[model samples]
Target: MERLITYKLPKFGFPRLLAIIGCWAYLALPSQADISLTFGTYAADKPTETVRKYRPFLSFLEIELSKALGEAVSIKMVIAKEYEHSIDQLANGEVDFSRFGPASYVLATKKNPDVEIIAMESQKGQKRFKGVIAVHEESEINDLSELAGHSFAFGDELSTIGRYLSQALLLSAGISGADLQTYEFLGRHDRVGTAVGSERFTAGALKESTFKKLVKSGVPIRELTTFDNVTKPWLASSTLAPHVVEAMRHIMLEEANASAVKQIAKHGFLEGDDADYQLVRDAMEDSQSF
Candidate 1:
């Protein structure tokens, strides 16, 4: 296994380490609860810097959830500047709930085995997603194998289709992450596409819907193509009880409620089981074997 476990460093030292490990073991024993939830996101910008400008869609997320829950929920939205840190926070119970891509969710489950996936997103009601290796229309790269030594941009290391899928494709094509001349994290899909189009990166990964949205908004569709494709979907995290999971799942399937979630991330939550996320688990195992 890749052993993508997340650990917390106690403020004291060795004694606290033993205690924390023991506590984790105890929590892994499993319990149930009905409690107010706090949600976290990997989207918030840095703390000490000016916010990364974006559309006002986030306000709608807060508003819609509040309406659905019929109470003020504590949403501790923060930027996941580092993927490991995001998983660590979730593992330590610093955040009770979160959303993650396929790779991050798998990594998180390793550390917090009790963590439950609560929801998943889809596009046009389709949960299957793919990774795309895109370049400018005038660029020379035409295939995943041709990307060697070329500069690239990844959305985030924890991204399912963003980085992991693209990397898997590259590795399958006999290229390694180290073979890249340079690579950068543009943070989000839009920036990744924009960076590639502006020549900051020779090629990059993009979700299919993001590409379509860009084109629909008047960006040139001829700017990119699929060098490779990998399927991924949205996932939710919860350390709550099964009843809670079942409740949320039921609420998410309500057509009006589902529509609101879909508007937030281009996909709505759907009923899922352990098998629904097996692709991510399998990919993680395969990546670690390398």
Candidate 2:
């Protein structure tokens, strides 16, 4: 019987037999699934510039997640065309995760309370940052109170610093939308800066980073007021697996220190709390009347 079976089996050399056994072993082992995630955000800048600024961070995150999980990982970036659309996408579970500004974060939670904050962006371990109301360098509008009856520029309507917080500041100074002779939501920080710089608008509100960038690029804009604002928060969808959210949170807090992407949050991330956004909520409430 043994002799008959040997004859029936194809002749195999020692190396070939070992190779067959190895193949069988590999086949028998269970496969580890690849981790694929989609990251979402709004293009507060130009779409191409937003992609350029975010691609490196996504690549870095994928490499780190792969190493930490012992499996291949990939993160795809989805940039929304507008701020409100980005909020809608997150609330509707169109993406796995997102990085939302404070105002948009508040709005997203309102739309879907299940949205989870994974981490908040930090600046050198600090969780607070600055927003600026900018005016053309030669403009006589030296104060927020001077904005009355002058054309004002704003970024996306949902922008934290550019709209909500800036509006709060203007309200504090006794100015309202009707107080301005003209105002427009230009849809981007760069546009707001350029509008003010080109003398199209008398003053504009934008994040401090964008204000500095425009000034450095010779846009001839200067800060009229600088106000404190909460940093951005990274959020995960409620529909995402809990394990994946935990793993992503861990990776962001642990692996982001090695990230060299200076265009975004350079210092890494910190644990976030809903209470951290109370100021934005307050500002939003105050802005409703404006």
lDDT of each: 0.62, 0.88
lDDT of 2 by residue, 1-290 (tens): 45544447789999999999999999999875488788999989889998888898888778867877778988888999998899988999998899989999999999999999998998888889999898999987777887889999989888998899998889999999999999999999999999999999999889888888899999999989899999899999878889778877887777645455344678878899999999999999999888
Measured with C-alpha atoms, the lDDT of residue 151 in candidate 2 is: 93
Q: Model 2, residue 134: displacement in angstroms?
A: 0.6
TM-score of candidate 2 versus the correct structure, residues matched by position = 0.86
> TM-scores, in order shown?
0.67, 0.86
For model 2, which pairs clash? none
Q: Model 1, 201: alpha-carbon shift in Å?
A: 2.1
In model 1, the Cα lDDT at residue 250 comes to 55
lDDT of 1 by residue, 1-290 (tens): 58788998547788887898899998898553224555545652333331222122334444545555565433345556666787877766777666666677777778877777666665456556655677876886667778788898888767776676666666778777788898887777777777777778888887876766665775543334453332233334545546545555555566766555554555655655556677666655554432
lDDT of 1 at 192: 79
Model 2 sits at a Cα RMSD from the real structure of 5.9
lDDT of 1 at 185: 71
